[model samples]
Target: MLKKPTSAYVHIPFCTQICYYCDFSKVFIKNQPVDDYLEALIREIKAYEIRDLRTLYIGGGTPTAITARQLDYLLSHLTEQINLDMLEEFTIEANPGDLTEDKIAVLKDSAVNRVSLGVQTFNDRHLKQIGRSHNEAQIYSTIDSLKTAGFHNISIDLIYALPRQTMADVEENVKKALALDIPHLSLYSLILEHHTVFMNKMRRGKLNLPTEDLEAEMFEYIIQQMEANGFEHYEISNFTKPGFESRHNLMYWDNDEYFGCGAGASGYINGMRYRNRGPIQHYLKAIRETNHARLSEEVLTKNEQMEEEFFLGLRKKSGVSVKRFEQKFGLSFDDQYGQVVKELRAEGLLSEDKDFIRMTKKGLFLGDTVAEKFILG
Candidate 1:
């Protein structure tokens, strides 16, 4: 039997404005059916048997874009289903400008204990260039507001290697981030996803991103700076103080199943991974008609499962546990990937200790390359 998921992800696909690099299922919250969408989202959540959840992450295009009343309604209905006291962490992603005092108060009244702000850069120029609505001032104000409201378990995201971003820019961004004294940080390199404005600009030679070596240097700089600031590099792109690591994200890196609710949300349950409809109308229609909005589902084979375990588990700083792998698959980790591991080790990408096999710093940079070696097919 598949283990019951203790974590859940809710997607809010509305944003005040779309960023140039974002490709997530999101729409401008102008004339959209916000009330209908919220009702449909609740309907979809009710379809599942309500149980105590360990982590509840409400991510988005921007969850904070909704009005205070809307946020209260959403959280109230959510807590009714998933017992609030049982949640180890309840996170809501917010954009700096969108997080008004009223909305923060709504969050304060709810079970939310963590707030992750998408403060992609501290440079107002870069922020504007990237199509972000908020400026540096707003980011500081939002952080201040969140802290004043007794929300200390706060995290912020920073993106490096943006178009025309320099080493100086990255340093400035890091310095500003560290000064915030936040508990957690998620630093990511810019990835030009298909359908994003950045990608279109790149095709037209209009976007000048950092070179691979410079990008790697920026990554290295972030790791060093975060470590110096007393943050642990718990995951590839995540850093945290000792106990402030995001438990909700840890659920994903651990390859644990989770319920994914809302438009375009993805969930893993009963050994099957499924995605909900992306279009708001379609999602609403599905939820209204069938009480579920699943668009597609895929059941993994044994080989697929093993590959996922390796790839996902290795993303953690602790790497994959030999005992856990053997117990789960009833096969020796060495027997299955002995040659691959040996090669990676010889290349100085992997190292094995008593119970865990982990990636080295060099391997972490080439993470995708290392992970792809484990694909069975």
Candidate 2:
């Protein structure tokens, strides 16, 4: 049997307003059976019999979109049984305007120690273009409130190379983000997903996104600015101060298993990966009838598992360990992937030392292309 995972993730699929770029399973929080959903979600979690967790993340549509009482109820029952003393980090995702004072109090009293705000940009006009309800002012006010409330371990998400966005705009965003004095920042290039407004616009030639070369330039600029400001480029998309790396997210990059709960959530356990029902009613009905909401699962083969280790591990600046790969898979790393690594290093895309095989500066730019070469298939 596989060892029990020490991490857990819960999803809350209700947003007050939807973004043009978001395709996550979520609904507008109006007239949905939210109370019933919450009760059913808690019931499903209880069925897992989770006793202790080192990290727990409540991500969303918007966890803060719910009422203060519901937030308290969810937080309370979620941790009431788990050993709070052993829970290292509990994070919840919030929007800038959604974190009301009452909800803040609820979070402060709970075991939650970190908050990730969806402050997509500091540009107010772009905020509207992206269908975000919160403006630039609310972003500052919300951070000020969070800091005043003694929640220093805060992080924000920023999207660059947006529609009609310029290099100067990104610079301003970086400058403003640094001014906030927060410890972590996630910068991503805007991606148009299927079934989203941006995709449709792109089909009709209505969307004006940055060119591929410009996007790459913006990424390089972001890396330089973050490093110059004392933030470590710990992961491809994440920057952090010395001790403020996101432990919950690191669990994912480390390719460790974790329990996923709530609607549209996916979990991996005992060598099987499962996804819960996406629609709220389906998820609720599954929990009501079977005490679980899993819809489908897959058992990965050894080759697939090894591929995943390289695919996910290479995202970190520290890259993959040769010894760890051998120990985990009972196979020779150099014998299995030595030729591939040799070719990548010849292309100036990888660097290997005695311990770890890390991406070179060029390799980090073409990360996906480099990792695809390691697929055993």
Q: What local distance difference test score does each model get?
A: 0.93, 0.93
lDDT for 340 (candidate 2): 97
RMSD of each: 0.9, 0.8
Clashes of 2: 0
Cα error of candidate 1 at position 197, Å? 0.8
After superposition of all CA atoms, the RMSD between model 1 and the true structure is 0.9
Which stretches of model 1 miss by more than 4 angstroms?
A: none
lDDT of 1 at 210: 96
The global Cα lDDT (0 to 1) of model 2 is 0.93
Shift in Å, residue 11, candidate 2: 0.2
**How many clashes in each structure?**
0, 0
Worst 10 residues of 2 by lDDT: 1-10
